[model samples]
Target: MSERVIKPVGRGFLFLDSHPAGCARIVREMSGQVEQRTPERRTALVVGSSSGYGLATTIAGLARYGIDGVGVSFEKAPTARRTATAGWYRTAETAALAAELGRSWTFINADAFADTTKDEVLDLVAEQLGGIDHLIYSVAAPRRVDPRSGETYQSALKAIGGAHTTKSLAFDDGEPVLQEVGIDVATDDEIAQTVKVMGGEDWARWITALQERDLLKPGFNTVALTYIGSELTGPIYRRGSIGAAKADLEQTALTLAKDGVTAWTSVNGAAVTQASSAIPGIGLYVSLLHKVRGLETPVQQSIALWDQLTGEAPLDLDDDGRIRLDRWELTDDVQSAVRAQWESATQDNIAEVADTTWFLSEVRRLYGFDVAGVDYEAETEVDVAWPDH
Candidate 1:
């Protein structure tokens, strides 16, 4: 194993390396916060379950609910000289903790959009896990290969109507700055491809495959995590190509429900995630939300979601028939506050106006940096292996 002092290196929200010790520390901490409900054996399946909401939810499912579950994610392993993706290290940490706690948690580092991964996961579920009680689809992929056509599709992060200009946080070359940014509109092909990559077609396939194999448990329920940005980003996000894809995802829930599969879409609150960082205006909005209204960490939000899913209370839904986890972040007063900040905050007063410092820290934490008590100055082991089943 090689060890060296690894400092974070990346422009904007892009992260290059992850720290093993820090990731393991965070995983252990998240596990400590959750109380395992009933030792009764149940199983869960999470697609794209290595980072952001998926990772947080998976940790809660196994640590809190003690469910024997399988987490499906695609993470690049470390090259000879480069470090592995943060998700890779995080998965290893989670599996180790699960084993230590005597819980069955399997981590599959494979292309979830591929048919081969599906076949392998389904076979394991059918033969070993017995049945799946909850399936959480929280995939955030830039591109996907159609299992049938083998054609790769990539999603676009742009407006739909026309070129839209907005003020957002830019933390790359220097201090965090809020500046005007313009995004071009996506073409017809881009819209369709974006939906193909981010929509619920793949999710439907998973459900169909499981049903064909009779792998769904009695009273089984599934949820797909989605987001609807505030009016500040309505054009670039809520009414953009990405929004179109999210709409398709929400509609897929209804189609799945028609098939007798208990499926629903859960609209989650904005948080600092790799995917969110790539979206226009989201970083600035989340940072402003932190300054105005307190922001909820993925771990905290996952706990609340788990409580609702496992609690006796009826699931709260809006008129559109989707769970409203983003309610707190989308309150009338909070949105008004964020709008005022977005319109007025500039490079000189960004720190004074928005919580860019905390937002950047959260982004760095996604890759295991900025974590408390972890000495980034000291040499950390770069060869953290992913735990095998």
Candidate 2:
């Protein structure tokens, strides 16, 4: 019954609090964009179902397909004088909408990387949904505690082999300032640790667990989200430490295929996500990309992805057996235009050349600020239920 007036607490990719009402507004808007109706009885497991592309696709699955299944994410609850994460609010709103739409869902606020969580999801899938037809592995985290070894691994954003100096961004009193950022090359251990955290080993484990329990449906398909940006972002993304992890992710798909499981590394288009804000040079690259062409949001991309996966069009695959959704963002012309913007960008004229307005607004939107139709000036209820409740 407590309410508070919440405003954005941080700026320029850093956040300290999220507004429940703003987050709910965003969830409602995203849910409204489901144009396709998949009137089929299917079950799905979304590992990271609370935020970003994971959150987007999960909403589409429910709104489009009326799916029955589980969504597992680790989001903290709100406290006195502090708001919960945006995903916390989104999860609650998603559950409400699912119920209103007459769909069944189980939102497990638990660690998806742990073996116990997998076991719980499998049991739920068996008891509630009988089998899982689609498994969306969209998990993203900064660190992971290995369930087997109990060792903690952290993912790094450094480039491999050598340091990469790029036009990066720094925030000054909440405004972005373009600067040259240099990152040292990742050490051998650093690379391995990043892979251990962001790689596909955990995904492979999930598939094996489902197979062991016979919970995988006859046409069970799984996709792990990945990014292989063009040469502009290659040094820090496609060929960087995270890129090594993505490479392992794609390899895991091939390995799963060899084992008679249908899996693909879904190379998705980049839009604004909270995780992307922390990576080096990504802010500048995304800003330039936005200026050259309007960015396709994660929600929009996920809707198109669902269509390709379930609709009449064949699942588009590249030579390496990955779903290609970054074609527009990676077009030669787009990259060339973006590069032009990047090379000429300065703090004096960044907004003129890059979409700093969009970048700033989107980053704020990640934490429930800059959302439409939310009364930021008025007091809002902070305490919201988890999706399962």
- The whole-model lDDT of each prediction reads 0.86, 0.86
The regions of model 1 sitting more than 4 angstroms off are 172-174
lDDT by residue (tens digit), candidate 1, 123-229: 87877688899899999899999989989999998899789998878785546977788999899999999999999999999998889889999988899999996
Worst 10 residues of 2 by lDDT: 304-313
List runs of model 2 lying over 4 Å from the truth. none
Clashes of 2: 0
In the order shown, what is each candidate's alpha-carbon RMSD?
A: 1.3, 1.3
Native-vs-model 1 lDDT?
0.86
Each prediction's TM-score versus the true structure: 0.97, 0.97
TM match of model 1 to true structure: 0.97
Q: Write the per-residue lDDT of candidate 2 for residues 57-162, one digit (tens) a residue.
A: 8998888878777998999899986888889999999999888989889999988889999988888888888989888898889999999999999998888988
